[model samples]
Target: MKLSLKKIELTPPQILVIGFAAIILAGSALLSLPIASATGKPLSFLNAFFTATSATCVTGLVVVDTGTSFTLFGQIVIILLIQVGGLGFMTMGTLFAFALKKRISLRERLVLQEAMNQGSMEGIVRLIRKVIQYSLTIEAAGALIFSIRWSFDLGQAKGIYYGIWHAVSFFNNAGFDLFGPVTGKFSSLTAYADDPVINIVSMGLIILGGLGFVVISDLLDYRKSRRRLSLHSKVVLSATGILIAVGAVVIFVFEFTNAKTLGTLSWQGKIWAALFQSVTPRTAGANTIDLAGMRQATQFFMILLMFIGASPGSTGGGIKTTTFTTLIGAMIAMIRGKEDIVLFHFRLGKDRILKAITLTMIALFLVIFVAMVLSTTEEHPFLMILFEVTSAFGTVGLTMGLTTDLTDFGKIMIALMMFAGRLGPMTLAYALGPKTEKELYRYPEGKITIG
Candidate 1:
């Protein structure tokens, strides 16, 4: 008798996880090459892996100064990684599939659906094409604005190069910057803190890029379909606006007299810095103010914002605006003794609410657990350690100047956090969990008490 074997198959989520890991590893290998560094010295395995993780995750955390440490060639690689990471690997794969005129298989569409967090597999190819086209167009426009402003400052060729570099970085919400040397290494956008042109353009790109592609698609369909905003678009826009306003106000209130971050600035400069700081911390890692100088209250507030992060299907990471809003909806419904979680006069599915809860719980668990691990490895202030862990978990790269001092083990811990942050707590869970299960029997329900 002949023996029979079963074929192995990967779930969409598992494929996504594997795909991102594969890309990060490849990027790490390339970045570790001697030619990839400005000093002609290749980064050690840990550093290279950290940088690649930062780039591929679009988290903007760096072990080395991107500008002073990497050559133009290396910078290009980093930006390319950001581009791939920002748009997501599957989104790019679909675009390339279209470019090659290859038929997108059903499995490929399913992967794209999962990657994009879409409701269905329908029109995934077209959606990806739109995402790529819109992304490039927006990035090009941003680059042009930057280049025009810097043409005389840095000369045409170099200015254009710098402009394009930052445009990509800004749109991707990756805070890796070449805007250093004049001030301090890894100084970020502090040198141009008061430059309205740079600040406005970069912030605009960050906001637009952070807005989920679904929202963009819905907006574009408005004129053609004559339909109102999708529920998701409405929730994301409303929450994003409120969060930004609240964050700016809180930052302004806390740092008005700190004399380090928002203080001591010209009145106009203060407002701009405050607003920029408020916006950037929410998944955009660029900073015009010293985060370390801000009060604990302000930093803690920012940790909340970072934990909420960008909306789903956007370049930036976090539990997501939808998840946050859903939790609130669930709470409100419970308080009112309502059976359904209603939002904007729409009843959300129980499954979605449960998922939101699950993601949040897992995220909190990861943050607390990792922070504890970090506390053991380093002798930093507890709040600072918590801040760093939350930042990594949110994929927001703002640090309290503690990233460079981390031990090897600490670096690994943060890297893991960044990876988990980018993939998402639930994504990691599902990706690593069993691929399939059959539940043919039901068990008696048990009630649990809650405060």
Candidate 2:
């Protein structure tokens, strides 16, 4: 007698994302119990869920002080949540499957493709392995450097733990920090700022992590052969560099006379703060200066920086550098009456241009809608609402002192934005599953012209 066995199906990306989110929520609830909190007060389930979502999304927006509110175990849970969340749930799932020596299924490859926002599934398995290796290597290096620096500041044991925790935090772009009191205090990083080794190492990790895994893979490949960088890498690197430099210059110019923040700083301190502000807004959520004390113009500038965010396929979130660049390039091309959309000597497809435009519009709309909702529910100014919305959508975690005052509805809205930002609006859309319906008839094209 022949017996047939039924095949088990793997979970879809949406289900997987939700399941992981549930696990994080449950974990946060358990950790928020009286025994796990620093104040010995049990956290409300809503607060715990919000915090869990924020952490899992690698978003730094917190209703409570992470350092003061959570115990060591709770903090560890948040860190782990960030690690998995930053890496993408499917990516971690794939790594576990690989560790078990299990064959990666086609569905898994598709999931990985969606996770990284790659155009193709070819070499996705290899890409996933490389991503894991690269992440570990970078995180380890960051931890080592941080540990060495922290050792000199603190004792060996504390420094070692600090190093490891911060390394994971920075590399993952999760802004949770042990420096609770020092968060808004610029005096905390005074020692580390001058220490070139620590500053450079941390910034280097941030850059590498924010550069996107695709760019890293491309660089690795280019190293073996003296070939040029891929278009994606070129665009990402060039846009990122230009944005950082411009942002730094803008910050330096604007805050040079503030007196409270950058104005009173020495030349070196000013430059360091400016540079940190510029770079950190690229979705790292680490700030050297007091964000609340910045000039309105500077705050607006930061909003733009946070919105543009880091490169695609990276740990950081935003509209992405490439998308911003492409949208600008497309506009320029259109204004010049050019039929072909070309950038870096390569012609961009209409689909790409359309996707970029759509993503930007959707992101903008989401931010605005959430901000409007918050304005109505929370007792904050419109500017503060905008700041909070941008913070959530960018996953930058920098707030203008309004996070704790948000109502339950406002928190949930921001939580949704954070989730969408981290997973990516497009990825979340795709996770709902693609809508594939062929049109039976083509409609007549209508043309309208406007400036």
Candidate 3:
């Protein structure tokens, strides 16, 4: 008798995402074991699950203090999850497949196309190869710089490890720190903020990682061949610059006299903190100040920054800077009664506009719905709940002190939000199954009176 088995195939994105979720869940379960904790006590299932999801999503909201709760092994697991999550499991899987000399199927290419948001698959394999190469090179450089700086403060071996871990965490925007109470101590980076080496290196890593691989690829290719940058790259870079500059100026001006966080800092420290705060909310969660102690205005500003996070196809999350920019352009065009939405001399198609609007609407609804649910369950103030929801949905992870107090249901809600934020609502919707095509019908174009 002969028996044959059938091969099961999944789109690259689906396999990558589902496989990562499985790995995270399993890792969380294993880490929940008694031996995984620094205190040798097993963590509750919910806490373990929450931590795992947060790490895998590269979101830093934690149910327990990472520094005190988990052992080094557990922390390593979390870091690994964050790194994988940040780079994306599909990219890594494709790289391994390529290394193994496995031929990528057409379906896999389509999945890859979706994953990278590429316009074509002609050079996707090469692109993935370059992405891996560039990511590792940059991350290694960041780790080395951090390691040298940390060596002066911490011992040699520990410093090297911390440097590598934090370099990955910060660049990936994972925001998981093992600095103990010092994580929240917020000395304005006074101890290391002015180190120049640490600040510059960390900021560089954050910016490069958040810039999106497509932009990096374009820049690299352009430098090699002296070509012009793509319109997408132009838009992304322009928007990013404006947001960073505006955010920094606003933060510096507002907190100059708060006396609690930025006010007490020296001029140099204040500028450094302001820059860090501004850049961080673009979805990188590293902080030079205590977030809990910030003024209400600063927090509100942060909420806005977090909502318009790093660029598309980047390690960070949120609606994306490009999406936000495109929407703003569309709005301006509409206000001027123009039919075309152009940016950087390139016209954005209606499909792109519709998609952007849909993404923003879905993201907003998710945040608001989760906030309402959490407010009811946790009894937190509306603003705090909204902040937490936005943080989770943006995968920004800069919480205003409500992460640990969430009930089981609330934790699950947040986990779902993080997953949605990272994978994207549209992608998740696609993965759930194909949508039904509209049957026969044409609706009349109707206009409604608006504000």
Candidate 4:
């Protein structure tokens, strides 16, 4: 008799999914420990799992108040999860590899390429190094600013701790806030709504995080290279600015007289609240206003923004800004009777257009299906269910007061949605499907009717 072992190979997408899931499970285990709870009792496994999933996915929807329910050790675990999730596990792996002076294998590079959503493996290592440098630099600056402002409000020790915690949270777009003791549990940034310093710094961190690291790298390199921005960067920047501006205006207009939200604020306060609210809805879940009190129309509009979400390779999620831009470009091209979709004088390939459509359609279906399920399983209103579903699918973390009241089933489903959204629907699909094989011949082209 002979003993034999078979080696198993995993695709990059499979590796990413498993990596995130493993981190989430480990985080859950740590959180479930007695020391992790504020009251010195182990948190429920379900609550811990949900919290871990939310943290690891960088989706901030919480069943337990993070600041009130968890101890310092727990919060540190959460912050670590957010950092890894925001940067992707591969990025952290690369950091460890660097610390040990170990070479990243070719297979690891391939996984990194997929994790970062890069077009090629070339310069992947360099990009990861730059990502580390840029992320730490930005977070440090934000933390310094926060500490300076908060030192007058709180003692020096508390200010520094709060600064580091929140700076990381905001920069990673994690939306996890420790304002529970100062304000109220689940209050998010509402206490700082009128504070110009808080509003500006928070929004800046969110915007930078949502812009995607690749775009940041490109912008940084532009000064040295003196070349035009890549089409992807151009589209991301344009879309982000336009969305923020439009979202701000719409929110200000709709909530201008809503007393529960913006009406009680001064003119300056109103502007700050409106701007911050607009920015946070796009995958940054920190809210300066009472989201549940916002006008239904405003909430629905935010749902759209949440769905469009942040750019690719960004800490934030959703179908991605590039996907949205590509779909819009394709629509415009079709309306103009053009043969190809063009942006910045560059024609997009058919594959790119098809991928965008597929991604958007899949995302739409996922949100809809989850919303339907939640609506049926929970006692919340349909709008609230839909909002939560979109938030989960977009990894946006915005909610209409439905998260804490969720049944266990709802929590699990939402957690799964968060996981799917973080890895991306396409990646999951690819990972589960059979390996790609080129067809010998193409099928005949067919035409379809249009509206």
Candidate 5:
């Protein structure tokens, strides 16, 4: 048989995979340039590749110091990658299309539809516009506040630049920071642990960015509907509120007497630090205190929080808040022996519940597999390995001094984990191979299970 010139069509997942890979490659190439480094020397291939992947994936697990290693040119490249990764290239394309007054075809709409995790193609163009506008508005406000504080420290021009960089970093939930101290390396926000402005602005940006665009749009539309909100909006808001509050309390209780972490702080400072750490680990990677100084129990709990991560369709990575919430609802329904799963007085769909469970299981399997791999490859404590693996899988970027010490293969393992985590476990699974066939035939059901 002779083949004609037929156009090849790619599935949404395939398109997404290709797009992300292309971005990562381009970023790596750019960062490999000598001008990207402050030392006027190009980064090692592996280091550049890892940084590029992390930035493009919006995962901030950098092998090098983001501040001193890279020059202003390199920093700009990283910031651009973060913005594109956080909002997605599809949104960027849509914006460009809008600017050029070009007509968006069905194919473009379909891609945007998948990118936004929307139910349909309606209003997607408009939605992207709103997302850009809203995100910039928030970043501008946050940048202004940060600039005021940093201006006093870094001087006028440098301060504004630093402020913009961090504003973009936090808003994207990318953990990369330029605050590596002259004396203390990779200090993060520890120097300003007692500073209210830095803590509040950073945490607030992370929370808002992690809320997901759909939730933001829902709330914006709520007033028109007599203050009514969608079930998703309500669930996300409730879960986020509960998690932040409970996490703060747990961290405070666990680290209350730990001198290295919280004991040295005054009462108000301790409370603020606890709250900041709690909120940061769930999604964002920035921390006001040294994570290694915290109690082991707090670190363990942080792994759980990191695994759950930010809300679905957000810049942040992990299994997502809704997935965790759905699992909880399912468990509650099972204990009650209810045939239908319910949350917020609405009946939960069976398909959604199955997706949640499957995603979580896949995520758990990935984390454990990586941890075991790291154990063999890295000569670190088992608990620390677990923490690093979970952190990479969640794209949370928080490390227990294990990031820089990873050997060659270990770095690759964590890099792959970060890529998978950024795309999400379920999404990565789907991209690997989605069940495309429909079964019209049904066989008799058989059940045999004992736990």
Candidate 6:
């Protein structure tokens, strides 16, 4: 196939913003069609738009039930959006480009770098190829397992279809689920709270998806070559393990006496639920237990986990594991009266530290501002509003029963929050800002502070 391509003048960040918006809008339109609904009546455009944004952003918050409300076409549309959104539009486009044997232009490479959050254009194309390859293999294995497991209960054909749908959703860190019929509407995976197969598989998919592609690739290569892991991979793994373990412990203790949550489960069930909850908060929205029923302390702890979120270049969103780790490292350096922020015996550059601080600040402000706005627009309690806002900004779908009650204005706000979260607060700032101007001059800095 011969292809003629004209140069696009947009910056990488701008292209990403535009590409994601395009997918969201197109998805919204399709979902609004009568054929997309289970009832054969057109879903309101607002609901359709919200659902599309949630799916494309891979945020699981939903105003409507996924299983009973949509026809097979709508579900298919959603899973496709999740796949494209999770891997990123550029990745899917690159796959097509590879199939067509089209040369990847420098501009396209730049876009890919930004899309994957890679530091350089070098080896970007190769990395993307590995990303797609690894993602498909993982999703296929998950789907086969889910299909076989579900076959006995749902019939072979339904099991297969659901298996594929859920595999895509889970592996993408998108919390969309079709258990609405089996469980109640918006019940998520509560029905499988004690099912080891379901809980284990769901957590496995989420963890793999949350671990960024680069880390995944590095781990795989390390296994083959018996090589030392990259510092980034080491920090990511360390932080991830610590967070999960701590979160599980905290949740287990906090919810142990609460009759509505972990208290009623068997000892083994409680452990599974605790672990699952811990993992899900890192931008994987599938919940095995009732989030609303959990103790407030546990909910707040999960909020912190959600805010730290998944690793960079992964399907999940938030400030990112690396950024959180960097901030903590910087804090430790300050406490120890050291001039350098060190991680794994290596000194971190000022630029990296500054970027981490900037990203966290931007994310924090965005989340706070959105929460304030929702507080005024909706009648929910301040805590619930904050949780909803943080969940949207973190692109984590866990909610305390607030999603269904949101006003139209509130819904739009949450949708925009999800958009910003998925693209990243810093990236959105860059895409919307004027051209960067290099300052040729600098003034001396003076600071006065009291601790």
lDDT of candidate 6 over 239-279, digit per residue (tens): 99999999999999999888899889999989999999999
Clashes of 3: 1
lDDT of 1 at 40: 94
Candidate 4 per-residue lDDT, tens place, 1-451, comes to 9999899999999999999999999999999999999999899999999999999999899998998999999999999999999999999999999999999999999999999998899999999999999999999999999998888887898899999999998888889988898789999988888999989998999999999998999999997868768888999999999999999999999999999999999999999998998898778889998899998999999999999999999999999989989988988988999999989999999999999999999999999999998888999889999999899888888888999999999999999999999999999999988999989998899999979
lDDT of 4: 0.93
In model 6, the Cα lDDT at residue 198 comes to 86
RMSD of each: 1.7, 3.2, 2.6, 0.9, 1.6, 3.2
TM-score winner: 4
TM-score of every model? 0.97, 0.93, 0.93, 0.99, 0.97, 0.97
Error of 6 at 370 (Å): 0.9
Expressed as tens digits, the lDDT of each residue in 1-451 for candidate 1 is: 9999898798888998899899999999999999998889888978989998988888888889998888888899999999999899988887777888999999988889888888898888888888998899999999999999988787899789989999999898888888765468879989777889988998899988888888888888898867789889999999889888988889888899989887789888888898898888777898998888889999888989999999998988899989999998888888999999877889999789889999999999899999998898899998899888888888888899879889999898998998899888877888888766788999999999989
Each model's total of backbone clashes: 0, 0, 1, 0, 0, 0
Ranking by lDDT: 6, 4, 1, 5, 3, 2
lDDT of each: 0.88, 0.82, 0.83, 0.93, 0.88, 0.93
lDDT of 6 at 143: 96
Model 3's TM-score against the true structure: 0.93
Off by over 4 Å in 6: 1-8
